[model samples]
Target: MAKVSNILFVHGAWANSSAWEKVLPLIGAAGLTGTAVSLSLTSLADDVATVKRAIALIDGPLLLVGHSYGGSVITEAGSDPKVAGLVYVAAFAPDVGESAGSLGAGGPPTRLLEVVRPDEHHFFKLTREGVDEVFAQDLTATERAMIFATQNPLAGAALGGEVTAPAWKEKPSWYLLASEDHTIHPELQKKMAARIGATTVTVEASHVAMLSQPDAVAKLIVQAAA
Candidate 1:
C-alpha cells in the first residue's frame, strides 16, 4: 500500500503559523504531518523562500495547502518535485500573469480596507476592529479580541507582485470555498476556483474555516494526501 503524504499549510496575511494549530493535529491523526508555514508576506521572494524551506524538510511526497494570501505563496512553492497536489482553502489561486491584488479587484468586501495602515517599511496591518470584523468574525468575542491583539502585519508589496507560475495549472488542485467568508467575497472564491480547474467543495464557515470547521478541512486534506 502507498504511504500517506505530508501536508504543509501556508497561512495568509495578518496571521502567523499558529493559525493552523487547531487543524494540524487533525491532519496528523490521519498519519500526515501538517506543517504550517509563516510567510514574511513582505515580498514574493521572501514568502517563496519560506515555503521552499518547508518543502526541503519533507522527505516524502507532499500535499501543499494555502489559505487566503498564502495561496499566492503555494502557487509558486508547489512546483517542487515533492509536492504532489495543491489545496486552496478560500485562498488565492491566481492563474499565469495574475497578481494577488488583481484577485481582489472584483471589489473589496467592505470598508475594512480603510482601516489598514502601513509602516515606513510598507507592511500593512489591520486595526483591531479590522481583525474582529474581517478576519475572526466566526470566533467568540474573547477569541476575536485576542486574535486582533496578536495579528501580524503583512508587507504591502506581497499583494502587488505577480505569481510567476501558478502551480494549479500544472498540478491537481482542490479548493475550499468559504461560503460565509467576509474577508474575500464568496463570489471571488468561486471565480478563482473555476479558473484553476480545481475540484471544489463549499462550507458555510468563515474565512478561517480551518479553525471554525476543522473536521471538514481535514477531511479534504486527508483525501488529497491519500
Candidate 2:
C-alpha cells in the first residue's frame, strides 16, 4: 500500500468546512496534512468539482474523508489517480446511477426530516429543534448552537443528482458508522459499507460524529491513511 500523504475532507449537506474543525488538528497531530473543502451544496456536480480542485492542490497519495453528502462528493471525485483511499464518516455512499435521495428513499423517516425547512429556492435547512435534538444530539449545547448558526442551506435538488462513477469501486475504502445516527440510518450505513466492500467500524454517536467524537473519527482516518 502506498503511504497517504494528505487528507481532504468533504462535509455533508447543510454543513461547511467548519464541520471538520475538530478533526483537522487531530489528523495533523498524526503527521498528515489535512484540508477540508467548503462545498456550495447547490449541486452534486459543483461539490465534486470543489473536491477535485482540492485534490489537484495536493501531491502524492491522498485520503478522502467525507461526512453525509460529502461521501457522495468523494464517491464521484475520488476517482482521481492522486486519491489513495476513502473514509466515509456516517455518509451516503451511493453507487453509479444512484443518487443520495434514491439511496435514502426506502429508509424510515427520521426526526431530522420532520424539521427540515425549505426556502423558496429549494434549499433545505434544519430547524433549531432538529439540530439540538436529533442531528447533533451528542454535541454540547454551544456546539449544537454553532452548528445551527453556521449551517449552509443545501439545495434539495442536489440529493437527486446521480453519480456517474463511484470511486469506491476503484479505491481502498473505510466506513465509520455512527451507530445512533438519526439523519442517515445506521442500518443504511451498514448496507452501503457492505456493498462497497469497505472496512467498517461502528461508534455510538449521532450523525455529526466528527464533532462529538472527533478522536474516534480521526482514528479511523488515520487507519485509512496508513
Candidate 3:
C-alpha cells in the first residue's frame, strides 16, 4: 500500500469548507492529503464529531489545521491518535480549561463583532457591511459579498464550551499569526502561541491569512508536514 500523508483543514465560524478553496490544492501538491471540514458552528460537540468523521477517513499520517473557531475544533480533534501535527492559522488556540467565548471576552471588542445580532434562533452573524470591511477586506469586493451572502451563522453558545483536550500540548504545533488581524488582537495571538510553545510565523495581513496569504500559509503547512 502507498503511504499517505493526510491534512485536514477545519474552517472557522461565519465560514465553511469554501474558506479553503485555494488552500486544499497547495496541500495536495505538498504531498499530503487535504480535507477541509465544514464544522457546525452551532454546537461544539457537533463540530468535534464532524472533525472525527473526517479523521476516520484518513488511513495514514495526518496534519490537522484549523482557523478561528476551527482552532478549538482541531485542538480537540487532533487528539486523535493518527494526527501527527497541527497548524493554527490566525485561529483560537485555547487551553483545556479555556473556551473561545471566555478568551475573546478578555480582549478589546473587535469592530467586526459589533454588528453581530442574535436572532430568535440565538445564532450570531456579521452584518453585510461588517463582513465587507472587517471580515473580508483582503478579498475582492465580489468575493467578500459572495461570502457575506452565504456565511454561516454561529451559535453564541459554542464559544462558551471549553475544550476537553488541547492538542498543542501533546503534538508539535505551528501558528500563523496575522499582524493586521482586525478580529483577534495580534497581541493575544502572540500570547496564545507562546503558551503552546508553537513555531510562529507572522504575516502582514488580516485575520484570514490562509485566504489572503495562501502561499505563506501553504508553505507553513508544507514545512510542518515535511
Give the number of the best model, judged by lDDT.
2
- Where does candidate 3 clash, by residue pair? 7-33, 68-91
List candidate 2 segments past 4 Å from native: none
Residue 145 in candidate 1 has what lDDT? Answer: 78
How would you encode candidate 3's per-residue C-alpha lDDT over 88-125 as one tens digit per residue? 99988888788888777776667866867789989998
Q: Model 3, residue 6: displacement in angstroms?
A: 0.8
Tell me the alpha-carbon RMSD of every candidate. 1.8, 0.9, 2.2
Superposed on all Cα atoms, model 3 deviates from the true structure by an RMSD in Å of 2.2
lDDT of 3 at 160: 78
Model 1's lDDT to the true fold? 0.84
Error of 2 at 36 (Å): 0.7
Candidate 1 Cα misplacement greater than 4 A, ranges: 1-3, 107-109
Rank by TM-score, highest first: 2, 3, 1
Report lDDT (Cα) of residue 60, candidate 3.
Answer: 74
Every candidate's lDDT: 0.84, 0.91, 0.85
**Lowest-scoring 10 consecutive residues by lDDT in candidate 1?**
106-115
Ten-residue region with minimum lDDT total, candidate 2: 104-113
Deviation in angstroms for 195 in model 3? Answer: 0.6
